[model samples]
Target: MEKYTHLGVYGVLVRDDHILLIQKARGPHKGKWDLPGGSIEFGEEPELTLQREFIEETGLAPITGNIRTAVSYTIIYQYDVNQMEELHHIGIIYDVELLDDQAVLRTDGDGQDSLGAKWIPLETLGLLPLTPFVEMIMEPAVQEESDVGMGTEVEG
Candidate 1:
């Protein structure tokens, strides 16, 4: 068996009580909901990767603010029927505000990885099949904000 480690940066775009999510069109989590992000290109900074990916997946440029490393985990994905690779995913969840809240779902530009983007109510996330990392980080991210009594407020 061969193993591979994949490093990805993700954004947690929250507005009101809804979070922006993309429906995966390919890869291990195809057909599942996932954060707006992807694997970082070689020599690309994680922050840049987050920015690029957010736009690519959502079709809206993210007004990024305080970015923090949210969570890291390793999972085995069987890309082929008999081939499993260890994916070490490092998620850098950014506080992002969209330039246009009314931006409709787009598959143009670099948004091919996802079928489309939608704002889903945070509470109803469980109803969707979310990527493992998104599922793992959602609770703590929400809890952390609630704990501070600071709801979604994007800086700049």
Candidate 2:
């Protein structure tokens, strides 16, 4: 039987002139840098989902800012083990800022499962091999140009 799953409760965390990224530990994108987030349980709000995800993946309490963008994507996954094919996912990507300035980077496990969380510079982001949509997400915040819908998450 083909399985269709819903993935949510995810966000792109930005902090102190840098963005926080997690190295995937499993699945198709394992070993690649990705925004820290995952599936939202039933009846859970997106913001809550992301906050919970941060603690689970990075061991920090991150605060979300704005809803930068929302897009629905149809992903085709064909599991080689069982030759099963499936499709489905409405990815809700958001912009967020980390409150903990003195936070340290930490890896979850295996240096792949949820391994390594760090704030990398925008310049370096383009150079590194990151997960899908990650590089694009930073484009708005890093650019100097005005009119980039940078909604305020909080006050300093």
- For model 1, the run of ten residues with the poorest summed lDDT: 103-112
Query: For residues 20-95, what per-residue lDDT tens digits would candidate 1 score against the true structure?
Result: 8888888878899988888889999888887788767777764564675567777777878878777676676677
User: Once superposed on the true structure, which residue ranges of model 1 sit more than 4 Å away at CA?
Assistant: 100-111, 141-156
lDDT of 2 by residue, 47-94 (tens): 888887787788777476567776544545556776765546556787
lDDT of each: 0.76, 0.68
Best by TM-score: 1
Q: Candidate 1: RMSD over Cα atoms?
A: 4.7
Can you give the lDDT of residue 80 in candidate 1?
88
lDDT of 1 at 104: 65
Using lDDT as the measure, the top candidate is 1
lDDT of 2: 0.68
* Residue 146 of model 2, lDDT score: 27
